[model samples]
Target: MTTADVRTVLTDGDLTVVGQIVHASNATLVCDAQVGDTVVRCVYKPVRGERPLWDFPEGTLAGREVASYLISEALGWDVVPLTVLRDGPYGPGMVQRWIDTVDPAESAAERLDLVDLCPAGSVAQGWLPVLRARDLDGDQVVLVHADDPRLQRMAVLDVVLNNADRKGGHVLEGLDGNVYGVDHGICLHQHDKLRTVLWGWSGEPVDPVLLADLDKLLRRFDGGFAEELHEHITGAEVRALQRRIGALLEHPVMPHPRGDRRIPWPAF
Candidate 1:
């Protein structure tokens, strides 16, 4: 059966739900979930009837699945796996393997300085994010003082280039006090979908490993590997992806926004 069909069995079996569309405008079914004894989290087009799924970007879920497999193999990132199945309750939806870790919210609530997702400026190592703000549990989650001059900057440029499917909550604080990026279902897009708050290192020197990864990406793009994805992505998107790789290589020095780095509303 298609992945969509499996979600049905999951929800019907009575799983513990954790997440929901924070905005009502997004009635789409999503949950930081638990199935049987397995912790699972996923989002999908809500279905109707005894087994009806509502509207969602059809195959968008599937495409993310494809993207996850590729990046996890290349980067060893903890990309979650999802299956678009018939939600027995929510109807048609995607079922995913849940991550077992505390989120930034729980971390902050418990006064735990788990993983420092601060900006990269003058300290530490590893893939720490720069800007992390969440509205978890109706109490806005904020920990680090925004003005920490020593914190490393966020890597919004890398995120955008990756076309990451980074919902605010998908990023996690592992028990090991390290930040683990999850939910890469919508990444490595062929388009220039660079939208993130990690801009602290915008104009800084590129990390050797990150640069190496991008170079590898370019080789794959020009090779038959990218061809395998043509059926799944748009031509413009492919070009946009190439453009990002080339641009980052050429000019990896763009300053962070003068003030708030938030993308403008109604960007249409």
Candidate 2:
């Protein structure tokens, strides 16, 4: 894909931003559609780290914003709109669709008001942890009480993709009793990263129901997942994902790998 060049980004108080939206765990700028029927959203990174090509193949952290979106959309998750936006403020902003995370089944679990929940959010110094602990089962996301199989599928897909931000708040439940996933800007990697309270069920074997879902996902992954990932992530990263998928299918309850890699508390 050709890099998009936009020249009119804005950061006034009136346009829904009390502050800048971001994918801080990975150093990205998040924003909503400023214009368009399609309503483009995005996360952009303008810097290329030294030996930048050695790390995550999702491209520059900013570019990962797009790669993250592509991976989620391909898996059929209801990811927020993610784009490579340009206009004002920062250089390239990763634009993501504004999603309504209000499921009647569950609360949008509170974002860890803690400063270290996300590394990028930590340095950008924009996000301040909520200053209170929250119950994931609380009605902060969607407005429902039971787990939607589809949403569960998406969550499982996230683990396979190595998403590090499956905070209770990020898994939104909708009024229609549907589950919508957001904050995928830090996803799709070759790392063993997997950390979440949702894994209370981890180490427990996959039951037949979840196993069935895996069967379906395996089929889908083999079919279109490859072509779709090729668009944004590198061949090696995509191959790693394929390997990860195989591992999950064989044993669904392994301890999440990357939980230890993240800073549990702020270095600051």
lDDT of each residue in 74-116, candidate 1, tens digit only: 4433333334344435545445543357555644553424233
What's the distance in Å from true for residue 114, model 2?
17
Output the TM-score of candidate 2.
0.55
Expressed as tens digits, the lDDT of each residue in 1-268 for candidate 2 is 1123222222221122324434244444444435332223433333432124344443445445566656555545544343433333444444444445444445336433221233222323233232233234542221121223554455576666676556655665455455656555456677665544344333555556655655665677667776766766667777877777677778776443343443212222
Model 2 per-residue lDDT at 180: 58
- TM-scores, one per candidate: 0.53, 0.55
Estimate every model's Cα lDDT from 0 to 1: 0.45, 0.48
